[model samples]
Target: MDAVLSRLKGLTADELREEIIKANLKCGPITATTRAIFERKLARTLVENAGLTEPDSSGGNSAWLDSSGSVVPPCATSATQDSVTGEDGDFGYGMGLNPPEEEALSGTVCPCNVENSQSETQTPSKTAQGSPTFFYGVCPLWEDVLARNERAHVYTDKKEALQAVKMMKGARFKAFSNREDAEKFAKGIFFSVKFPKLDHPSMMEADTINREKANSFKSPRTQDLTAKLRKAVEKGDEMSFTELVWSNPRYLIGSGDNPTVVQEGCRYNVMHVAAKENQPGIVQILLDTLENPDFMRLMYPDDQESMLQKRIRYIVDLYLNTPDKAGFETPLHFACKFGCPEVVNILCSHPDIDKNCKNKYNQKPSEVICERMKEKGQFQEVKQKINEYLEDRLYIPLLRATDNSSQPVIGAPWSPEPMENLSPRLPRSPKDPVMAVRAFAGPLSPSKADEFRRVWKTPPRERADHFHNILKSDPDRGAERVGRDLAHELGHPWAEYWDFLDSFVDLQSSEGLKVLEEYLSKKDFRDRAHEEAGENETSNRFKTPSPVRLYDCLQKRGIFFSS
Candidate 1:
């Protein structure tokens, strides 16, 4: 581990001060203890990842990958692109932190703001209609990890979890050997803010959760089994812990009253159970137990841990490797993406952990750090999963106008400067693309820049000339930003696909829209035009389609055709 980070493990403020003074570092009259911890963490971060011996006045790495999945690399070292971007500044992909992933999913159309206008409330376990929904039934591997943690009852268990997390603190992290083991270990130490049992003991809540959990066919529990596992490991009752868990291997293999089968939550394989708690012996015991016919068919999650154990012959192998072998992600990504930091020390060590990583379209982890911070918008060490990459990863899509109303260009950045000064020709700075589609631009599909114009009227204070000359040059460019805000409104990019599908319906309908036009246009006019003279131009009139056509199309798309 890096020197500073190693010292930062569960440190108090006074210890930090003494360490700073002993090291002979500068910075006068620092007051708060929290600041001391943050300073120390930051210092360790700089020492471990920043490559700069001196502290950065510039808020760490200027450019990084945000949750949006857009790469916001350093844009010329100078600060700020706030002209059109406002207080957030144009870090690159023009969208603000308001909707981080939306900007990234939006791609080039990541600029529009969704935070203020629309009211979106997600009831973590429920659908938008307040109905319930669930995906990935019975994450058996996940439950197993929880069970392991529940078994380990000790403060040191948290310490171990903390230490395990360090391996993932930097760029170029490691992957578990295989899916089963990895899934198990990840689940064991997975971060979660709302413990289902902790927050919702009500029957209604339990019913709702169990309904979802039942999909995995697993048994239910009020609190997670992890606390028990965590305690056992904490105390050194490895022998008792192992015996208690494996006492009836027969039960695991399904000879019990209910029989061992996959469940809805808390799944894990033996290998993962071992790696998550750093117990190679437990893993070996599992392998030994699996020789029975009932356990043989059962598979492990990702196999990295089992493989790691087998090769090195002990759990100690994990500690020996330096930065070269560590696989930490940004703390934000780790916290929110997975939900906890019990094993986070390894991940926060990397430099990019703080980089926004978002482009104009998506949100990076840092924007989250900005949120979890305190009253003045500050932070020391981020703890909550809600604000960052927790089990509660928000999948907010860009807003969809109820009708065919046009939204402003999202990922595209137009200049605040006027047109004549804007260069007479097409703008290459995606921020200022000449959105007008030429005649040859492929027929009005979403990607051809055909739908960039506004379908709605201008807002107050908006100039008509600006709307005409600078804002929009055609109907096609006026109305869409779907491909840009996919993270926000997941249906946007697919909007065109649906449109194309509807067009396919039109093709089959009385309209005969696609066939005649595309067909004759592609025909060798010279070869058959003379013989055909002017038969009907064959493309003159168009036919109208019935709602049934749409119904059929929706059915084909697996949407409820009727009902």
Candidate 2:
């Protein structure tokens, strides 16, 4: 995930678009008539979710910054705050809902997503839990070994034998929740891979998420596949159109009620195929056919940045608004990174383009490139052109750090000062001050290393540093909490999480910061006491060396992060 983000940050505007194109996200033929579907939904989502700030022809801080829309530091974005938390409504998770309310919405389920219900049932049928492929987060190189090897659980988690269940009487698999639990709550076992079967409800969610049309209309498999193929063109599929659609020309477009659309089931039609293949030309074609109001509405922001409009907006903005949103991002976020001219042109020239568009990350198109240019050799002349075109010199915020540090971490606000959008210099510290998060729990970069000096603000790494400092102040409190937090964020548990705790203790003891602090304070207290000759001995001179050591003989390199 971090690598994906880094690459996206590294790409030029054009390259980012190519990356989007290569991601094969768009599908279906684009049509001239599709404008008829100009229902407010697509526009609404864009206008509502995307920045309404008009593009400044003169390039100053976008209306988003200084205008009425701007709020304190975190910048109120187009997407609602709840969207960030991933929990919209229904409080106290696992809490019961009103029985009457549940009954009111009964019988409303859609059936198109039936496959997942059955898929979940099929999990225990084949592979055993101990299988290598079953191990979550195993390095890719180890996938084949994990698949073929039978002893993954032994080295990783020696205590609990990897059990193989032929079948459970009733296996009700809840992929997300169960997966999270297994990863978080399971016996903290590494190589603890549990592939739960898909569930019916999850499939339904995917249908809605992927934008698969699941109306009552039905079409024969033959005719259905054809329309699906046609829809793929505008969505951006090219090479894939012929292969998928031609394979079954006889299939009718799904439901006859919707003659224009293919009858095939949702999510995996020719549009998907084209998207998978990055067929931009084909996407153009499909978009042409679905000339209905739904075309623009198809932007899939949350799921992998799917949809042609999103891809277009993402690519354009990265080249334009960069360095402002600290390369705090994924590939889609790079449209604004410095040094990518080719990409910027490709994105800017597109029709229906919103010059001030911000991506899911809440950065504008110009923010992408402008900040980047500030990093490398001077882009003064180009910056001037940008200023003239946008009508303002933009001041975007740079992401705090770019290393293995975690992003999206809720850090407290830095002192008041506009983070002038500028490229951070090598020891990549941002000129724009940001509120530094205090007391985070995660891995620290190597102490005193060059990267450490600069990347300290980066998450997990920075969090790791905070952990050590806290340990010095209070080992017991710090060590206890560090384990759980690292486990959740790093996706490690047991050996790895424990190892971090152990190492921090050792470092504290060896460096003796705790001891040094205790000694200094005690010495000072004793001197004061001798002078006063009365006050009770300084409350039991701060306890000395803590009792913690490197316990894991069985941990990986990441867990041992002494650096």
Candidate 3:
């Protein structure tokens, strides 16, 4: 003890201070108490640096630090001076930390040493504290020790291990066999923070957590039960559906419960199979069985959608709308395309259903039906039924004037962007009142005439252009000419006026003449005609409704002016 003190005293103050800083020991103002503390701390460091401790002989040996702060050789020692090796094998005080495990020295380094010139180097010591343990500088199975601290997380159970993993902010941690080992390793070292050093409670917490996990599933989705349930759904066995559901409340929680349950032959999950096959009852039962229905289910590799969006929400915005793999169609699109009117009706009526949602080809469900209608005459009724189901939400195909007046004109289908191709005559301004009216009118079907009539309240100027364009594009304009030829009958003084009316009168039969007299005799028409005659109405003939008005009158009276 005196020699150890003398050796420590011989160290320069700077060396002593360096040792104090290295071991992370507290250094207060030099006083009797603090000076004694420094001497003791320095003595321990010197003993460690001197390589006086026994070499490790066990296949896996660890540092055996003692309460008295001394190191001992791994070789057995007796009450003889020869054991200490003081310039010879002589007895010296040992750390007395751990009982010597073996009979002879195995020549392994026992403890860290000071005085690098006198100390012999050996392979770093390894520990027996199971895997994920660390040595002074070696971590054989764990990650490379990038950074370390004196404080280490110690856990008795997995619950504590996991919790420590979260609370401990380092990338990795070291395990210790006992609290004493942990305390010794943490002694006189710097650590960023204190970790929870817990015991048996951690085991209790782990057991409790495991029990909770087990209880979450009322019945485990075992192979037999899941297989039976899937078979029932595929076979449309209502009895099996009920039985399986009653047996395991969480059976339909997710598709991940059973990966092999094939429904309706496609790779889709059971919900999709039920929806595709028009099994509404099965679909409802499956939906009711889920705990968290809002979690997204896989449809296509690229698409993901919530169960509510799939079954209930009729309308979703573009981003949330996911299309299935087959044609990138949604369930509603599939229902309508496959002629599942019952499913279509349910999905259509859902407030969250996006009726106008387009498929992979950028075609809406209505467009899909219409396209099918062109190939299958039977689909005409289906189209009508779907339209009836969709009512105000239905899309109308655009119309253009055709040679045959009685036959409805079906032009190119309407799209979201109506101004994709504007007629050169049409102004580029999308907000132009005339253009909006034209675009709105472009998509109306002959069947939607009533809807058009109710909604097509264009401003008078735009309305006039709408009429002029319609009349000007009429291929069979003989009826319009017949009405125009009546200009001569204004009872005006012009020669051209008399000639025109005489020609029109010559062409009329007695019934036609009577119909013409009744139409021209209307008080509004007569008054307008008198005013027009006084002001040369022929030049302003383009604005006159006489052409369209007469056309309407002829059609109403069942008069055929053209062959």
Candidate 4:
């Protein structure tokens, strides 16, 4: 049971799900969402199913009484067992057992069969308090033997067993608590080997020795170098810092004796310190020196070239993006907060920089700049530059796709001009042509329409209130036509909802314009529209809106708007 539980723990979530399905266990979606849940549920099911199959005559006793009358098992039984058998000439000698006992441990008879035979001949008292049992055998594949001879080796120490396992040619041996697990694992492989559990006291002593050896590697000289390196960063002396780092690159590895300075509970590394001090040169020097191949070799002299290169990349990334201990703010966050545009620009252009990394407060570096602007009434220029940088990072590909060479078709079905003297005239009410004229003339002036277009181009947060002011002033204006015209101009999909405009206007009057503004200005809604239009499909194919779908959504939200 312990072996099976251990094996299940090693499986990934997807692999565990596969195992559950193969076992024909009933599992729901929620159970399959996490690896820990899947393991627990599956382990419970296995234990329960194991309990159900132990009563058959062919099935041997799942457990036996130990010397203390506690339940143990022969042949290392799991939670359940079907049978146990050993063939003649297939058995090997047990460790520390006499030659006379070898016959009793012969392969021709099953260990459980011997127990059953002994039970029938011996009294209950003798069988209940039997001597301690030991198992010994070699698997059919002799090529997997660790020791040259067929003799089984006993391991009372954990370190020796681990070393033995590591020394095996194919590392084919698996250590389990008992023999039944060995048999179960053997079914999937051509060979199997097992090692006994190590004594607890020896393991603890070995751990202590290893810890002592590791501590011995850190000398007074290394501590002095670390102190000097940090001092150079504090003084903003780039040449001294560079010399210290290049002399022994290990000085840059960790926080060492004098850990990074903490301000307001936030621990700052050398990069953070440099950025906060507005020393762009020091930051640049650190960046260049940290990634140098020669410095990397000096730091990790024992590693292979491939492994050394990978470690160097990881170290460089950690230096760039490691968050402060308290706020989880990266060095880039410090640069923005200190209003150092030069440092910010240097960090932003680096290929490995994580521009979108959020702090514990869920604010990105640009957001930090915005918050600073609000407090100090400064950094407005810095805020604008950061926003521009973010926008370029996010939308450059979209801009490249929509560049002037492959221009989008922009005219919708309706004309942008006034509807007074058109040849194909708009629909009019037969009872009141004057009323129809007023409705078709539209309420917004040309400048107001232009303002609406400009509002859409701004950020989403800025659009809502501006839209509310524009649409609230004249609720019955031909706002729908203006929206369609603006959509055509910008190659957006809002124009596709033209037929539902009356429903939207009714919704605005009933629920207030804020609801309408939120619906149209939602980032998710715009993204969905773009996805539905196919990212590359930039033409203005203004389809009519489905009134039923629009009404259904409104009704679900407990809103009724007259059309």
Worst ten-residue run, lDDT, model 2?
56-65
Off by over 4 Å in 3: 1-193, 198-212, 215-239, 249-251, 254-260, 291-330, 347-367, 370-563
Ranking of all candidate structures by their TM-score, best first:
4, 3, 2, 1
lDDT of 3 by residue, 1-563 (tens): 33455555666666767767776776656554566678787667655664433322122122343323344333333343233333122111132112222232322223334432123332232321112222221111122133233234333333334443453333233446544554434331333344433335886776564341222335434565447766676567877887765554445433333322333333344544554666656655554433223322212112234534453232122212346555666666666666655556555543445678887789887776644333475676877777756543322232222334332222232334333332224334644332111112222233453443333222246455654554456534322322222222321111111122333332234544664566556524332445555565554453454646766655643245654
* Candidate that scores best on lDDT: 4
What is candidate 1's lDDT per residue for 1-563, written digit by digit as tens? 12345445445666756656655665455456456555665555444342332110112223322222222333232233323333222223221101122232222112223531121132221111111111111111222344334322111122223333342221011234333443443443433332333334596665654341211224323122344443454343557556544543332333222122222233332222333444434434433444333222222222344442442222112221111112332223323333233322222322222334442336554433333323332233434423322221111112222343444333221222221221224335644423321111111223222233132233224545544543344334332222222212222112222343333222222234444345445544333324545654333211223345544644443334223
lDDT of 4 by residue, 421-524 (tens): 32224465554222111112112223433444344334257456655564455344324333543444553333122223433232324234555655555523
The regions of model 1 sitting more than 4 angstroms off are 1-388, 391-471, 475-498, 502-537, 540-563
Greater lDDT among 1 and 3 belongs to: 3
RMSD of 2: 33.6
User: What's the TM-score of each model vs. the native?
Assistant: 0.16, 0.16, 0.28, 0.39
Number of clashing pairs per prediction, in order: 117, 106, 22, 1
RMSD of 3: 25.8
User: What are the RMSDs of all candidates, in order?
Assistant: 33.7, 33.6, 25.8, 23.5
Could you arrange the candidates by lDDT from highest to lowest?
4, 3, 2, 1
Q: Comparing 2 and 4 by lDDT, which wins?
A: 4
> Each model's C-alpha lDDT?
0.31, 0.33, 0.42, 0.49
| Candidate that beats the other on TM-score, 3 or 4, i.e. the better one | 4
lDDT of 4: 0.49
Q: Best-fitting candidate, measured by TM-score? A: 4
